[model samples]
Target chain A: MIENAFYSQEKHGPYKLFSLGNFELEEGGIIPDCKLAYATHGKLNEKKDNVIIVPTWFSGTSKDYESYIGKGRALDPDEYFIIVINQIGNGLSSSPHNSLPPVSMQSFPKVRIGDDVRAQHRLVTELFGVQEVALVVGGSMGAQQTYEWAVRYPEMVKRAAPIAGTAKNTIHDFLFTQTLIDAITSDPGWNLGEYRSNAEVADGLKRHADIWAVMGFCPEFFNQEKWGLFGVESAEELVEGFLEPFFQMMDPNALLAMAWKWQRGDVSRLADGNLAEALGRIQAKVFVMPIDTDMFFPPTDCEREQQMIPNSELKVIHSLAGHFGLFGGEGPSYHGQIDEHLKALLAVPVSESIVEQ
Target chain B: MIENAFYSQEKHGPYKLFSLGNFELEEGGIIPDCKLAYATHGKLNEKKDNVIIVPTWFSGTSKDYESYIGKGRALDPDEYFIIVINQIGNGLSSSPHNSLPPVSMQSFPKVRIGDDVRAQHRLVTELFGVQEVALVVGGSMGAQQTYEWAVRYPEMVKRAAPIAGTAKNTIHDFLFTQTLIDAITSDPGWNLGEYRSNAEVADGLKRHADIWAVMGFCPEFFNQEKWGLFGVESAEELVEGFLEPFFQMMDPNALLAMAWKWQRGDVSRLADGNLAEALGRIQAKVFVMPIDTDMFFPPTDCEREQQMIPNSELKVIHSLAGHFGLFGGEGPSYHGQIDEHLKALLAVPVSESIVEQ
Candidate 1:
């Protein structure tokens, strides 16, 4: 696979690159020279009191979070140091798509959500000389990571904002993700991971897109606005309008790896295998903002999580854009909710001293 | 394709053979010695005012509606005469699967919802000597056929109940149906429509199941039950639980043909000159029941149709079973709603004048 520039100082950084120099993953695997792509904006104040961390979503990179980092928005670089880390298995980070030899499906690693959190921890504490993070904010798979940070290291994370995400994978979400993986794996051109040339699994990719298009919106949205569902005049337009963006720039293997991570995300599997206990460990001031129309991460699921953890508040984003509402723009226009939450978090006073154990 | 026993019943007295003889389709398509594999349990009443028509869902045989045609149910054999017509393209129903020189994908006829209703009309008006249907009821695609009966030949259908169905095809439904067709056609073993002797496309069949499993139920159903999302141990169970039945008995060609009909099932398109005027032509008393939790046919879609029709009632069947709640067996079951509606329809005083029009 061709390497794309994931971060540019002009756009995303003065960044730091961390390499494990061949480290062993928890799930009985080794990634030689395993690299974690990341970027940071603004300076870490004395005592690192104003440091904020935000992880990336599935197939999302550190750069994707840039819009939420800069200016007067949430985690404003001018007010607090913000760390954005590329998720493992995504293109810019270490993943099966770009990994050397042993490239078959069998060689793919089975890292869990805990592993992602652990890896991020190493990058923060060991490499960056950071001991505590004031807040961790994320959405979707990123939210999974934020939850992990709070639960896994209650002493380190003081506050968290997990937006439009879930504590565990829902079967409905899993089925959709699994179908996309199956579509890629079943393609004849997939060659069981033994293709000799640059063969693309066109049909499988298109089939994957077909699954995404249906679940991405409510039936009401399509009925109200028929023009956007599939394309008009010809099916080609429909295919182009929906499927092209997903497939044109995506690496099939990277997609599969992320899907595996998503399916394997089970924070409940930790904390003596009791999920609720693990959530209860979080000392952070928690804010769970689940998108109302996000079929994948419905508000009820978020509300359930909020009810489980102490000092947690549930913010329901009433929007019709479904899962993608977290990436606010003209369609969902969720800037108001995002802005309000950021203001509250910034305004709240931090505790002067940590309670000594 | 193995001969499906469900479609092996006799039609028009003597076992209807596959040669083009006893019946012909309205599309001008000829299937020599065409046979409709159907079953009937109820005896014709003395006045035949107790006749009830139940159409089959997608890929379903006349056998599907058998449970409701027993001795004590609404369509009891001792009281009402029931006609459960085997839809065309269902393997055993004069379909492409078992026909002589079996029809290839390219040669398969394009069947409209109207075609299925017209064929059943022939059986009702000619063989059974029934001038008007006491009640026409069905679910999902079956509901589509019931709606067509009332819309196409209103005078013949006295009352209609279309459950968990839509008046016009939505983009989401069209896309999903299209994916199913694509799964069958794109299978390498398909061999351009001549792979009958080779291995059936198991992968493709599995893909078809993957496409359907999500739409059949809600996220809560899967989450609360701890069903596997994917790659988890429960995935196999989940897949089998949802998809196996649909694929095990379905013929690839027949599946494709039926899917095409589903995709093109837009009654609005029938109004070549004027849309509103067409819906205004219907004379049958209509009841549109949309499953409250159905992702495929949201109740609001049915509400639009209810609003448009001159005389109609919109009912909601609330259940977490999603799209399949129309067939759900337990609490809030459609069976009770159906029974109540049947009683109401039977109670309506029929005007003595036959040719009021």
Candidate 2:
């Protein structure tokens, strides 16, 4: 299969790129000449103490997070050095759709959330020569990586806000992820991920979009006719106009690679499957923010994990858009809640948190 | 496409059959040599005042209701004559897999809930010579039929209890059902429902089962590890051992047929999309029962419909199993609630209900 420029910089606009030559994965595979696609805002201070890191979510690029990174926003470019990095297998980065042979396409390296954190680690510590991070925050799959960062380098991460995602993925979520993977792989056009074009797997990709239409947003969102806010008058329009085109344009194999890792996201692996022990190791002041209406990462699941971490609070984000509220579908109020919480998390004195730890 | 013996009476045990040669459909098509597969318990009293009707849900047969029929249960085979009828396209009935060439497989006529109600109407009136039915109760698609029966023949149905369903299929539910349909159709082996063997569409069926696993049960069921109660130790086993085997045993075309009709279940079509006006016509003592945790047909949706029925009462059934509570997955308390509600609905004097109406 030839690499499709479906998610390339030329198509989705330019972003900064870094090379991680033949990077080894936590799941025991290699991404030959692995590349990281990222975008930045603001500038690092002379002390490099005002640095912040945010990551991309499932099926998201560095560009999707632009909504939260404007002037006077929570991720204000004027206040902090903000870096929005893409996750491996998220098309813009080294992925199934764009990697070279021997370690490409269906053979692309399996990457766990930890692998993503470690790659970001090299970019932050080695490339930027930064020894401390002011904060690490993200939503969904991005949240999973944020938790990994806090747990993996507790001394370095002063504060963390993992939004709408669980550190230890639930069996329910695992099975849910399986259905998304099955949707694409089951198609004949998949051809073991050897298809010439995403159009070849159009039906399967559309099927994937259909699943997202149901589970990506909560029932009440549809019940309240909130898709009207998304510029769709009906459910059919929401699926075809908004959901279908976004997913159909992406490569199916890249999605499978990310899905496999998302299903296996569990920081508790650090403590031999003991969630409390792994979370107990975190020294950073953390905010476990989950969307109240999110069926994928319900607030209850997030609260349970928050209780296990010391100096952490469960911050519930109410949004009719459920999981997709990260994309502004939750209305203007959704972003208001996000900005308020991030501002508070940033305001907490770091020294006080260190003393408590 | 040849009819597999998968859902044949010879394979799933015998049921009485009724022929409606060249049966007409509500959706403007004909089901040639239409057959209704059903099972009856107890005898029809001389006055025919002791009859009870129960229709099957999607992917269910007459046999699946056996658990609720017994000497002293709500169905009470020893007292009330109970007839369980299978919906058209449900394997045992004349379906895409079983019908002859003129209108079989992909060409199977579209059937609305009203059509199933009409066909069952013939079996009760023409075959059994019964005019006044005592009670009609069902769950899910069966519940849709129950609502249709009450609306179509108001005087004939003395009491109606529609469990875990709504009179009008919500746009949320319509889109959700689309995913199930997409799962089967996207599979290349489906070949537009022309596959010779059900095994040819194994991946598609499994995908269907995966969707059911996520939506069929409430999130609490999975969060609390209730699969252990089902004799499965993990979610993987729950999907593979329980959900997969049940769906894999059925034909794809029949499932598509039922799913299509399910998506279009709107009783309001009788009064130009005015739900209140259509449900206001119900003359039966109605009991609209919805499971509190049910994501598909939540109590909120059912209560909205029940309010429109002048003589109806909203009965909430609490179950962790959600929609699957109909299949005993909600545990003993689930059936206990069903029995209690049905008994109360039946005990209400028919003349008093008529006077109230």
Candidate 3:
């Protein structure tokens, strides 16, 4: 079995796993015994009306958002029950790293954002007995799932906040995702997804990190040496301390699987390749938050799609951190804005028709 | 010996090579014999006063600028004697693929923008007996050399246009270049710069191409399926027909050499890391042209440095093609703007001090 040190609760947790047996995917793939790891905070009220779902971003586990949750933050565990779910292929969940023979590494089936949303729907509706989600919010790939949840089950998600991601994977996003995957697969030691250790593909991981350094943040983030805030003095140190080592410990196949899903993130396929028609299905109150400096999903790109959703509003987050700003790393400047928006969103009463049910 | 099909004059030329014996690099590297492949158009005036030097961009040879040259275009070879020189390591020049053992592939020394300008300086002054250049112009890595020429030998370059590149490689540019190098190096078949054939590291080249897709152009370029203009229907076709196949023909070690030079493109290093002081040394009338939508060299980024150069003006090229706009690929829309501007610049009378010579 692949080592669990990278994903176990001991390393990055205070989370639990919920076994999702025989999970079927939209793209015609099946995992004999699938599982989703998640973490929750606060209580599910008698009405099951105060539950908020937060999905993890690419390569992130449920616990990665611990700082964003709690008493007075955006998720605000004190006011609402927050469920942070780990998307499949992220090591903590049903990933290639942990699955058995037929479903492991090279044999892992392709998982789509829709498939992840479908599995999370079961966990919320069946296990938690939640009739409606107060909000579904996330960033990057997590934001992809948020859009998926909103369109895939319009009634279940009362409100949605998809940050730094779009309803469909733009061709540019697909290209970026492909490069990330190629970075890993090109590693000779990758051995067609049967690498024995992460060390074997260190060069690939480093390359992947270097790509992130280019696209993950705005040019100002590096030009201004903003990594200095993290106590790293130089660009080389920023890569060494943060990017390189961060990906080095993770499974390359797991990342490739997530990238595959990310590249194919298009809800329009559900509505027969019509983006406007697919977005037309979203009945929930929506907030499309895009980082102003994000290379892949710039504010203009997000605002264009946001205009297609009837009840959606475009909120441009001016951030030097670029896409990574959604993780709240620069400071409370962004998180504070998110908290203010979410508080206002939560303050609005739910529709009486749904509440009566 | 490596095949020269890609660089041979018979295939893509009307060019010649000038060999310099035992050329020594400023950065402590030596090429036993350095050769620069270049092409010239039109006739040299009696005074040799109408000469324009155009350096090739990264991965580009002298012939690649064919579309942008000619009687009525930007360089306007008929009006001005234009010499397009290939940057070292770009197959046509003294590259890893064509050099003999000691300076081939794994043994090729790192080349810099300063070194390229220095070689071109010799070609003009020593070989052509040209005391002063009418203009020094280029884009991308070529643009980097444009800046280098203006600063290093300001007296030689009367005017300069550095398009789609900056005087210093921003941390973002460095990171992007690093990723490109890493992608090629990590390919198992690369065997530490000793690949047998281009097919050996095809995966790496494909990944490099994918990264270019993400950064080389604006999202609008791909979103509108602009590749369709090139007779390609889908993104996959764009990659297969254009990107992948384009890089597959080039030498990986040659690319790595260029990338190393690109990453270290900082004229500021000459002034003890004083960007303003370094840019202040330019005596040439400068036009810093950056593509409005370029991810790596946005107008804001270019404009910042442009402000530091005393005789400089910032020209933002508004094209959806982004950085590729410098290549004049989005039709006459961009090329027209370049022509209009270059015509105006050339119309200015030469400095009396230089004209008297």
Candidate 4:
């Protein structure tokens, strides 16, 4: 593994390249020169047992998640070795945009939540020599990774919090993610993801943002004109000023890659299509936190998954902003509520919460 | 007015053209040689007071609505002169696809619910001499027309039933319509509304269908897999077999124009931005029927408009199918409920329901 200094970390995140040579994917295909980008805060103790893993969500990066950690925060770096790993295809890592010519752009190999979890496991165990995870918590696609970690390595993950996401992607969500993919690919500017610049596919990117405008934010959010909370006077300004530009900055292929992974996120595959059996494998004290108004992953869907877990509780999050509340777009109240739940989850002694083999 | 015999009516609808010569659009520009396509059932009574108008919805034609008018139905053709008018830009009329070269395709004049109502007004009075309409009832974009007819000519429409749609489009609903527009226009094949064939824009139409697959159907509907009731084995079949093929058959330009009108639906302009005052002008006995789980026009949004209309009653339609329940997608129960409300609304004595002029 070729480890390097955290580059974008100075201004963006504490992101470092942990090269994995040629990494295999859950879907058929190999990612050449595969490296997982991650950011770390605080130092590992002598025992290397105080580590917390937070995988990044779709279109999210390690640097973007820095706001989630600080002194006295639930993910406080003061007493724990906190790591935020950027999932594959999320721009910062060995993504479609940055990969070598043989496996570049639209030709990039498909990724899965299992593949991301496998890569993240290698980084935590091999690089840091960590034997146990104190906590694994994340939201949306990140929450997807959290579930994978708990199910795949039940003994390793002591406690897990999967917020605003589902253990198994529903038919509705699967189709919704497909729309995101279709939005980009349908654009002539995308040119099948061969466009020289992101600007080339601005039309497709804008359409992609439009879908998010409708589904990412809750109806109550738009009905109540909560876009004003984001400091935008009108909904058009929010879509044009905020959502469009944010999506435009990213690569079309990268977004498509991540969307495919999200659509296929289902731990049920581990138990041969039995979701209940798959969730029962989780030994961690899991808090399945779903945003109350999340249009993508509603509380009802998350509750079904939580009921299957051995030691899990359904924690419904309050946020009119819906799915985007994972980004704290609705302000302190969204994060404040998340921190409270995480704080409570982290405070519980792991030894007592976990089940013994 | 150059009135023509019903053409597609044999296999499709009793569609006859009513020429409006040169119709002015509310959004500027005039459609030269504009005509509205309509179908009629039963006959106009000598009193011309038994007339009922049912407007075609977005992407819907008068033919598709033939199911709503039958023996013993709420819209019983046996007793009433039922006119199902295809709204402007709805393809069957003087839409972008069929308009003259100067104002064809991309250059087609923008349409509004008011413009459609105006044309319908001309047809009812000048053609059929309908002095007082027994009722003006429809759903979705059709509901927009229903509101327009009631507010624009209150005395002409004695009863109005707007189902699964709002009188004034909410900011939330406005943005949702924008997504439908973005989905099509983003396609390279759309080529700025000059696609040689609908097949060229298959990708965009499929994406458009994908959005409907997500938002048009409620989460509860998907969670329970009510799609099975549609006779489809899987959700994928429903989207590909039903939605994709259905949308692909329509001209993208026509769909876009209707979406623009649907997004701008609001009666507040009539009362200088006072929605309450605008709706208050409605003298028709109104039954504001919104589907309980409609994601596009939630019952709450419809309830607000219902409260403003003097004789309006909020009749929430029960259907987990959401906005598309207007089409009776959830089966006989959906239509059964809608028919029940319409039956009750039609049976009410208009003298007692209407206010004195």
iRMS values in order, in angstroms? 2.0, 1.3, 1.2, 1.4
Give candidate 4's whole-model lDDT: 0.85
Candidates' TM-scores?
Answer: 0.89, 0.95, 0.96, 0.93
Better of 2 and 3 by DockQ: 3
- Each model's lDDT: 0.70, 0.86, 0.84, 0.85
TM-score, chain A only, candidate 2, equals: 0.96
Output the number of the lDDT-best candidate. 2
The digit string of per-residue lDDT tens for model 1 on B1-357 reads 335443454422223322225444456665555655555666887776778888777776666565455565666778788777767777667666666644434466677787777777777776778987878888888888877787777677777888888757677688777777777677887666555632376667777777777777777667666343222346457678546545744667777777888776655555673445556656777778888767777787788877776667887776656775554443325567666666676566654424535
What TM value does model 1 have?
0.89
DockQ of each: 0.57, 0.66, 0.72, 0.66
At residue A197, candidate 4 shows an lDDT of 77
What lDDT does candidate 2 reach at residue B187?
75
Could you say which candidate leads in DockQ? 3
Residue A298 displacement in candidate 1 (angstroms): 2.4
Error of 1 at B68 (Å): 2.9
Give one digit per residue, the lDDT tens place, for model 1 in A135-174. Answer: 8988899998899888888888888899888777767788
Error of 3 at B230 (Å): 3.6
List, residue by residue over B247-267, the lDDT tens digit for candidate 2. 998899999999999999989
Task: Order candidates by lDDT, high to low.
Answer: 2, 4, 3, 1
